[model samples]
Target: MADVEEMLDQAREMPYGEARSILLEQALKAAAHDRELAFEVRLELTEAYQYGAEPAKSFATFSRSVAEYDADPGRWSDWHTYSLLWQFKWIASDMRRFPEIPLQRAYDALEEMERRYTQAGYGSHAIHTQRTYVAEHIGDRAAADEWFHRWQTTPRDDMSDCEGCDPSGKVWHLAWMGRDEEAIELAAPVVAGHLTCHVQPQGILSNLLLPYVRTGRLEAAAAAHLRAYRLVQGDANYVDDFGDHMEFCALTGNETRGLEILQRELPLLDRSPTPSDRMHFAGCAALLLRRLEDLGHGGLTVRRDGSDVPLDRLRAELESDARDLAARFDARNGTGEQTRRLEARLAAEPLVEHLPLTPHARRVAIPVTQPVAPPPPPAPPSCSTWPRRPGGAATSTPPSPRGSVTTPSAARRTGGARTRSGWRPSWKASRRRPCGCGSARPSCTGRRATRCGGRSRSAGSACSPRTWLWWRRPTGGCSRTATRAGAAARCPAWPRPTRGPAGPRKRSPRSRARRRARCCHCWPSCRSTSPSRWRRPARPGRR
Candidate 1:
């Protein structure tokens, strides 16, 4: 009915891609008339989504196929059907991970698993394990302990997890209970590399970091981090486990080392498929950053994928994300346990002064260093970073006693001579508008600057001097700029500094007050600056 071989080949080619899921769904539709072929597609699709952290689709597919299998038990072989029961364990475990799926449903799923296992003459190994996981999810230590006891006593059968995973899960339980000695003892084989799997040694080691530390085995604890992190650093599925490594580093006064772990695994935050995993990793990341902030590295930047982020800013963002996720879970679970736990982690005190991770490393603690800020840019040769205001009596040359503007250009304007500081402009002054009717020695043969409204004192310009604000100027021509025109009018962008017959132009009361009040950047008062320069705001409560 369907081109089963072709679809299967496509799925194999893209074993972990969205295309594989698409092809499987297509094959499933094409094989609806063929029950066996449809069942086969459902099986592959279920496994794909399950392992890929897509619990919803995987569970739905399992339910659909299991109903078909139950209708006619002889339709599939024992091997092909075994996945149905085994995958139930994951479904039950995931139910607890998501609070939206009612917690009661998790219990119901376990009961259903026990019923199915009994009908198939199977042991309770996997069901008991899932029950323990659900109990732990709700923070029910008493129930978790009871389920854990049953799981350990249950006989292993074909339905049980693999040898490698069984002991690793047990190690997690033991460590969680704070029975450090028992956890370490049970994990001896896995820790020593005797019991190995694609996921074992790393999973076992990550769970053991705190256990090893709490038991006075700091050396082994450090060793476990290095070995475990190496294996799991690149994988998103192990993000939660990587979080354990991060928290261990944070609590042991190895925040710098934890930072290295964060830099390598930071990208996993973008790709992690599980919500619970994302939540845990984010919380742990915040923990490491909190430690760094404590050590004065809050101003440092973390480089990732050709971009750098501020340590403190990123820390705040990740902690917010984790808290938001925890709130979602807590709202659904009708408890604040998740919020409580996260707050506790954020508030945890360090467990050690320093723990050197390398073999035969020094016992002395590494000193914490402050983040180094970049140096300020160099100033121009003649002036500091401060803008030169001719009116100021601060560092630079002060205004003349007669109050004629003594700008850097003043010396050359009077003559081609250099000033006392021995510096002069290499080029002539740029053109600017002129203003005001005033003069001293020689300009247009002393015809005198008439009060003409922005009009030149030429030909027939009959206009009165219209008073212009010190700052405002007309946009463009009815006028044009000259190379420092020697004449003055009534209106221009700025009134050119001049020697008035009236003895230093009388200042308005407001203008005088502003001149007396110096900006923090430009101190010692500036009486002659009509259009003031930019100033930095004084810090609060100082000026």
Candidate 2:
């Protein structure tokens, strides 16, 4: 027993790989001398092999531990029970990496552990969560939901050891169900707390990006993406989470960087990648490339490790790989109905489709064709309420006779203007015109009015008689409606100079030549008559 303890200590301290494996092997040999010690050593060996990424070896060692435990069914300890349950959880995770191993095998292992040690009092939450995750990957949504509900409802004992396991699974479940806000609310604090674990930080933050982006929390989403990227910076086995991270980069204006990472990781992924991993990476790559293309960046070349390839070609390659992976899955899994369905989903046409990113509801201002007219004068005020003058004093003066011309001071006081012909309502008064900018603010209407052809002219300009026309022409152009009878007729064909001498400026030969070249370049059909003069001179060796 002392020798076994020393071996375990050495194995734990040593870095993973050959050295630790040797120490663990020695411990396993020493443990065999006693049945109880052998059981303990076998558990440690299983964990060591798992951490070393030797799933097959870990699975075998774990089977041996289970066998040893079964041999002495009548005698059991809490440590043995807990070890068995932990092994069961990890086996499910292993099954994901090795699809040939039926997931049911892991499910049965957990059930056997539960039956053999019912009194050991292990919390069933972790087990249920693992089973739910397995069921989801295997396309058993109904069973997954059932197990998830069981996990959520299970009571945790004070002695439960896996307190940090809930966030990742819960966030994924809630996000999948479209309860994104609730998921974000639950996950944000946990991520901020900086918990460190294989499934956490990286896993939680990766999944959190989905809801964060959907809710328009772009800054939070960007932070989560960066944190997740740092967490898995060089870890290639995290291919499962790489897809989500790439998605975050693509959606948040980092598609180039995401492609660079993909190229760097391609070699690693090509070595021993599972069908699922390949499928996921391919999907993410295709989607990111598609997004880049949609943003008018098509034909962009990605250069990495001395190789250059256009994004379109990369997308095509990924799509082909995805299809091949789906075919392999179908071949291995057989043509059963469920396998067929899963394969179809995996190989569906349109390798990449945009994910729905819903934005918050807010009013969007659209350009109005005609300016909004100001409100009409209030129906002649009732005698009950006396009209107040512009100076805010109650006016005893009876309403001006319908067409009477009043002094400018009287017009200002009455909120009306007296033109030479008649009295105009307050809205029609020059001072109270609506701002034609489409903003509802009454003060902005005439502050900066646009002239003919949408040209913005300063207020009180005498160039043209400006009416509130929402549709203005481009600057220096005449408006069609204005030219018909209003502002356009009075406005010059081109804006008159505000200050400089108004005649055309003389151009130097060089400037004239530059203008001619520009005109020819912009309109190819209008090529310059002296093409040879504008053409570049030939190099010594070139024609």
Task: Give me the candidate number with maximum TM-score.
Answer: 1
C-alpha TM-score for every candidate: 0.63, 0.55
Error of 2 at 201 (Å): 2.2
Task: Name the lDDT value of residue 497 in candidate 1.
Answer: 46
lDDT agreement with native, every candidate: 0.68, 0.58
lDDT digits (tens) for residues 140-162 of candidate 1: 78989999999999889999887
Per-residue CA lDDT of model 2 for 1-543, tens digit only, reads 898888888888886555677788888887777888778778878877766535567878877777777787668787677677667767766665555765567667667645543556556666677677766665566887898789878876533334455677888987876789989877765687754455567778888886887887776776787777778765655675777777665665665566666776666556423557667777776777776777667757766446888878878887777666655554544433234433444333331222222244232222224578999875432223333325676534222211112223323554754443223335334333233232223343356663433455545332221233211112212221222223223322222324448765665555543333221112111123324433332334544
lDDT accuracy of residue 78 in candidate 1: 90
Residue runs of model 2 more than 4 Å from their true location after superposition:
1-5, 14-38, 74-77, 117-119, 158-161, 194-199, 271-275, 292-317, 324-543
Off by over 4 Å in 1: 1-3, 6-33, 303-307, 360-543
Give the Cα-based TM-score of candidate 2 against the true structure. Answer: 0.55
lDDT for position 404 in model 2: 19
